[model samples]
Target: MTNRAAGLLLFALISFAAPLQGQQAPAEAAQAAADQLEAATVALEAAESARDRVKALTGTVRAYEAGLGAMREGLRRVARRESQLLTQLKSREDDVAELLGILQTIETSAPPVLMLHPSGPLGAARSAMMVAEVTPGLYARAEALRRDLEEVQTLRLLQQNAAGTLEKGLSGVQEARTALSAAIADRTDLPRRFTENSVRTAILISSTETLTGFASGLAEIAGGAEKITPLSVDISAQRGELDLPVEGLLLRGFEKRDAAGIARPGLLIAARPRALVSTPTAATIRYRGPLLDLGNVVILEPQPDTLFILSGLAEVYGSAGQVIPAGTPVGLMGGSAPQAGAILSLSGEGGGTDRTETLYIEVRMDNSPVDPATWFRIGKGG
Candidate 1:
């Protein structure tokens, strides 16, 4: 072959060569992974226990929702592995025929017959040189096959684990949905602070200037000193212990810059569509309506002076001035579950609405924006 052709052929052969083998993860990465898995497992177990003990469906609903949130990290791990496994499987499939041919030749060839077939010294020398060239390729092919088999076994185990996880997640979601419906039905007689007129709400949405401005106006109209009772777990004391309102990857941290390069004083959570959002603490709904930039907004007061502003909802469930218990259903993010045969696309920083449902959470004390990362157990969505 010409030098260029030989180089190309060698490159093709190397493409199917044995992958450099080592521990699947580095020590640090593995440790971090273990920690995350442990956290997810703990959350799952807690949710299951809570669901079983709950006397009302409402409590079960919250537990189930929390379980789904916990499952997200595990699912994300599976998805990441799934991509890697696919690439490895494709490479092995591509090289299967070639590797089989090499194995067959090695298995059938007899050394004595090959040595006798070379009639002269020159012939033998040529044969030796040819043998020398082929030996390394044979070794490489054998190594590749061995690695491929090992990889296949690993992939099989991962697939089995993932299947079980997925089944549990699906079951949990179904039960949660059913329980939520029952809970809503049971609470049909619950009194509202004041009913919102759809016409006025729509008009307000159309006339709003900024999300913050609209929310500030609503707070003024709601008027008077805050009346909501304090939660049993003090907000300050529960720092870094607060649950996220929704299950999602933390796309943007407090004061992190967005796609427009503008830094915001809130967390942007990227979640799956229609993911249920629950209150992290007991709070009276200060405002629940749409804003100009934000799709739908719910401002809550966990304490008299502490405001939790949660925006980017597709549907708002609570009403203005209505007190909600901790873990109460607040609203929902836009989007449906990963549809059958549809791709589950992940998002990066500044995730858009098309692929991922994004929620914005901002905390304020005495009406000044504060970092929410300090208060919540922040983690990247699985």
Candidate 2:
């Protein structure tokens, strides 16, 4: 390959290499991550508690509805009572008027003048007349009518007080219901989403250690392993300017979880052409789909073994199984400035009983993951 081609090839190879950082996190990033976890946990727990509150509020609302029903009934009763009292007052008024009219007519009529011969019949009539005269009856009826008027006035006042009481209670009940509704709104997103966030965070935490280990071996060749395969590239133009694919910052370095230079997936190398821009890379079609994250992953296949996964460029444009010549675009090299490396057990979360998705590329002597560096060349600019 010409100098330009070699440089371009180097850029592709370096694209997936990670830089190692020792075991501590930057204070700011660590603090921020901690805060986020705290917030997420609180939110999730609150949401769980909300289920109970929601239930309680629902019950309270139902109770209020029942109370409203009874209040409405009471209001109806009060209305009927007022009507009844009014009817009673009106009938009493009519009876009083009738009595007064009878009194007036009686008063207007001339007194019956009986000519007594100063005898026995006169004496008997005088005694009987005192007891039988309509005047006393009229007076008694007038007194009874006055009492009824007073009683009706008193009953009207009582009805007024009862209606007022009912109105006040209803207002209080309505206010309580409105407060309950506001509380329900405040508690709205309490539980389900909270749980999901926790799950996502946990997965991220598990990857932390592996990322550390992979960073340390960056730029170094993998130890000679049986399954690892290294590809060399060269460019005829632009030489050094376009070949190395390190973005900038070091995301994470070697740690407990890193899968570098050890297991079946032993080693991996990925590439992205910086200067070979004119030639549309065939790697784009070679790795596509769920290989999505592989966004241009480096899988070195030896003359003797299955695929050994290394790393991916931030962006990819290929699917697996398609064969192509060298010098392809593969993908873009722009993830972490330096790149991140993580070692996952073959039994990574989604890996299930069988190993899958973990960076621990399965070593397949015939068909399994052995240590990878044994088979391939993993140099700074492979």
Candidate 3:
């Protein structure tokens, strides 16, 4: 190869390999996920005898979900990086072959013959210097190619072995969910603000046509029963700072119109199937069950006049009168969890949406609808 050609080839090789140096490898992300999964497994074991098993199991399930999410992202990145490396190698095929030929010829040629040039000793000396300068670059390029190939192989193996890890994680999360449900059912420690009168609640549900009207009659649902002291938890300072009740993507902002062009004073969150929905703040369940056209609903009273309405749940928990703590699981979003194979395939496909379930959240202050985004932080968790 001419001096110019050698310089250009080395520059191209260096450029191709440069990005790999500073960028974080997929293995680090995958390893972090593995660590998270291991911690969740330990938490799950500890939850069995925990004083508050519901809380313990909830954390365990969330940890598992987070780990699985990270693992999926890591795999997607691995696939993309591998594809990029392959394309770069394929595009430089001719250059690489030429480089190899030049290196081989230089290695095989006797030193005496290499030193003899057509233009005598001066020309020969210059040619020798050029060869010496280019040889190191050629070896470096070869080493870079070798590393890329090894990385591709490693990524493929990681993907292959990921299925078993994913399966275990899915199973573990499901078990934690089941255990959490049982724990919640057995929980009787929560104080009741007032016992719900089923007869009155049913009558109110039948009479109301809109959420506004339904919420207006919420107090009457308790009938003439004596009321216990309300929860002392104050959430005024938490406005615009509370985490979302669920992990999801913000599908629609406050009052954003839907497909039908109807606007509502709430936020729409798109979540994965059967994702856990919890309370962002300590609150009493004002109502819990099917209402209007919405799915299973849980209306919470965080203060005297402020209410948080969460709808579209597949399974609702807690009674209307019970006061639950923050991060308490109230229900689960509808739909079946994706199978392990499906999840792995989706990750490989990359950037495909698996958030099939939607959760509608509304915040009502002084019995008037307000944007939920004002009260809860957006874009974090959900």
Candidate 4:
């Protein structure tokens, strides 16, 4: 290659090196996820008793979900980086081939002939200096290109092996969920604020056509007007500071109309199938059952006059009038969790959030519907 061509190639190679520095981030994220998964595995193994098994298993499931999510993000970044490397390499194909030929010629040429330029002795000396200057750069560039190729191979292998890891993670989470469910069923230590009168509850459900009407009659659903001790926990002081009941994307804001043009005074969240739904604060379960057309519901009274209604659950936990602590698992969202192969396929598609189930949250104060956003601190997926 001519001196100018060699100089241009060196510049391109140096420019390419800068981007390689960014590649480490994805690998670091993958390593962190692997570490998280290992910790979750250890926790799962340590859980032996039914007493704390529910909490342990819940942590395990959350850890696995976080690790799997991180891994998927890392894989996505790896795929993008690999594509960028391939494109860069392809665009410089001719330059690379010329560089290889030049290196080969230099290696095979006689020392005396390599020193002799066709122009003259002065030209030959300058050519010798140029060769000395450019040879090392060419080799260095070739080494960088080799490393890039290796990285592509490494990324491809990582993706291929990820399927197994994801499968194991999926299986682990499912087992944890099953174990948690069994543990919750066997639990009998939680304090009950009052007993739900099934007869009265049924009558209330039959009489009420809307959630507002049903919530208004929750007090009458108890067996009798027992003078129950009020809860000490105050949720009014926690406005705009409570975490969401589940990890999910905020689909529709409060009172945001859907395609059907019907708007409701609630927040709709898009969550992954079978995702854990927990209470954001210590509250009394006013009701826990199917209500109207909103599927299964869990109504929590965190204070005297305030109610937090969570709808769209597939499996409800805790009995009506039970006092549960904050972060206690209340239910699981509907739909089956995606299989490992399906998860891998979805990751490959570069899709947005993989949420398939929806949770509707409504807040009520003194029997009046209010925006849930005023109470929950909603983020990207929480």
Model 3 lDDT per residue over 72-110, tens place: 777777777778778988998887777777777778988
Off by over 4 Å in 1: 1-106, 109-175, 178-182, 188-233, 255-264, 291-293, 320-323, 344-355
Q: Residue 366 error for model 1, in Å?
A: 0.6
Candidate 3, residue 245: lDDT: 85
Models ranked on TM-score: 3, 4, 1, 2
Q: Please list all clashing residue pairs in model 3, or write none if there are none.
A: none
After superposing all C-alphas onto the true structure, candidate 3 shows an RMSD in angstroms of 2.1
Tell me model 1's lDDT, rounded to 2 decimals. Answer: 0.60
Please write out the lDDT profile of model 4 over residues 3-112, one tens digit for every residue.
66557656655654644556667656766776777777777777655357777777777887787677767767777777788998999898777767778888898888
Best by TM-score: 3
Per-model CA lDDT versus the true structure: 0.60, 0.34, 0.84, 0.81
What tens digits encode model 2's per-residue C-alpha lDDT throughout 5-31?
A: 223323323431222232112222323
Q: Model 3: residues >4 Å from true position, as ranges?
A: 1-19, 116-120, 226-229, 349-352, 380-382
| Model 2: worst 10 consecutive residues (lDDT sum) | 338-347
TM-score of each: 0.58, 0.24, 0.94, 0.93
Look at candidate 2 and tell me the lDDT of residue 79.
Answer: 40
Task: Measure candidate 2: CA RMSD.
Answer: 38.3
